[model samples]
Target: MNTPVSALMPVGWGILLGLLAQSASAGFIDNSSATLTARNFYLDRDYKGESPYPAAREWAQGFILKASSGFTEGTVGFGLDATGLLGLKLDSSPDRTATQLLSYNPVTREARDEYSELGITFKAKVSKSKLSIGTQFPSLPVITASPARLLPQSFRGAYLISDEWDGVTIHVGRMDRVNLRDSTDYGPIGLASPNGRFRPGATSERFDFYGGEYRPATNLTLRLLRAELDDIYTQDFLGVLHLAPMGEGTFKSDIRVFNSREDGRAKAGSIDNLNVGGMFSYRWGAHSLGVGHMRQFGDSAFPYIAGGEPAVLSDGTMSADFVNPGERTWAVRYDYDFAGVGIPGLTGMMRYLHGDSIDLPALGGRDLKESSKDFELAYVIQSGPAKDLVFRVREAFYRNQQDAGSTFRSDNETRINIDYTLKIW
Candidate 1:
């Protein structure tokens, strides 16, 4: 169950007091900001494998209204933040219902046409540190949300962030429930592992995490984090980002490492995994080239929060995480910026990834492989009356030897997105 209203009354009272204080001071109202965002999304996927059903296609429109008030003036400042989300299914049917763009009814096996949710946060600030209770969207290395669909996923919990040191940042949080991108209910956290992506047979009511980021230099950053899923698992993450000058261009590298194992009680049953990878890139003028390699070790695959962004090392594509037990993946990608050719607000990218040496114990310990290719084009209105309007198209092709056993079968997937944001001060 979610935190009850009785438990949240103190937070509500704090918000009311903050509002009174804001009226006493002009800074709160003067510095406040609000925005309304509209998003249109379309998805189509064609499956290929045994018992291949018809294609799954869906269309959706969403609206997000976000508002934030400035903190009241004092040694300890207080503020409030709110978000409203509404999603409408434009096109969907029972046969084409697994698109993840709309909520599904478990009993009727029907997709809902509409869903809505509201989130509120009461925040307090002391010096450079801030604390917030209620719904939050945290994009940390170890715990991150997903925004790839019509409405972004969100976590309901408490978060603390501190930047008291010049080049150091600290984060600590506890999440008790999650609202999936398409679902309208709060649910317990679960691990998304290879054996069970959706029904892991394990759930946790508490997820605690702490981390710090250090920037020792202008172009160098280091991060370390630890997370625990009550009795399910414990995970540690380390990441580094560095940039250097190379000839007329710039070279950059992003590295991430993860170590996970079953926690006390072992609700997920003896989970042990190690994941490491890095992406290196060079950018010159309008052209950029990058390559990445990732590896998974141990019997279990890398674990991450269900229905959220993947926590693997490699950059994600439309159809694959490239993360299987004993699997190694390599990816090559190229990007171009039209601005360098005098066409601002336009960009294009292409990527190809191959995964091999996958060990699937369920299939008699068979070794298999997979590969995928993806392409994307995006543009935004730069200076016209419809400025800030953005449009994007993405297409992907994936093939796997174990297509029938994978979470998503070998297929071709396409997505189209349109977004516009209006700022209301």
Candidate 2:
């Protein structure tokens, strides 16, 4: 039986008030803030293969409300945070369903008219450390939430972060359940997605991680972290980043690597993967150029929670991450800021990625190849009544030669997004 929070609040309200009476400092209500965001989204995907599925085209609108309260002043402080999300379907069909923008009935294959969810988290701070218990959106080298779609995924658990030391920060967390971006219910954590992945249907009750970042200098940062999905897999990561200033621009070098294997009972079976990737970029005033590479160098594919971004990978796109076993990917990218041309809030990006030598016995052995070409343009209102409004579009053309072993089909996709935010404080 699920009990309402109101019924339990009274049990602790007195103690909360008693603590507030300490009165060393009081910023709770004074530092509270709230914001509401409105998003209009449209996605179109078509297949260019001999597959039996139809094209997926969908349009939807979403609203997200986030509220946070400041801590009660003292040697130790407490606060509360909440997030609410609502997605309304405007266009969809039985054949065009499964776009991930809306939930559909399994039997009917019809998308729902709408879906919504709300979550709450309690937080406390002591000195330079903070503890949060409940809903969370974590972004770390090992794992992170994805907001690339209509809504972002959220987790339920506890996390502690500390920066008490001068040059290092620490993080430890345990997440037991997650609400997928397209679903309204929380479920066990798993390592797979609707496409391009591994260990489908394998799930665990807990996902845990610890470790942090160290900044030895103003221009360099290093990270060492560990994560595990209980009874499934264990993963360790090493990351280094450095920025150097050149004549009129700056050059950035980033490297990330992950070594993973089976853990505990190994429910996902003989899991073994060494995921490695990096990116080097140079920026000069209005233009930036970059090259990236990511590879899966183990017996199996890289593991990550379903519906989450493979943030550690340098060349993951809407279609593929080039994360299959023994696969290697290389990418080139270019970005331009229209502000240099008198359009202050406009920007554009173009990138291409290719992967080969994929080893998947389920399809074929090695020598498989997949490639993606992507283009994006975005603009934000800089002033007037709509200062924060944003407009963006993304396009991708993906093809696979080892085809079935990688991306299921050669395809094209286009996405358009318009967003606005309003402060409710």
Best-performing candidate as measured by lDDT: 1
lDDT (Cα) of model 2: 0.82
lDDT of 1 by residue, 96-155 (tens): 777778997756657788999999888888999998888789898678888888899898
Model 1 per-residue lDDT at 265: 88
Segments of candidate 2 deviating more than 4 angstroms: 1-25, 193-199, 402-408
lDDT of 2 by residue, 146-261 (tens): 78778888888778899999889999988888888889998988877333445458898788899999999999999999998888889999999999998899999989999999
Model 1 residue 300 lDDT score:
75
Provide the lowest-lDDT 10-residue window in model 1: 1-10
For model 2 the TM-score comes to 0.93
- Summed over model 2, clashes come to 0
lDDT for model 1: 0.84
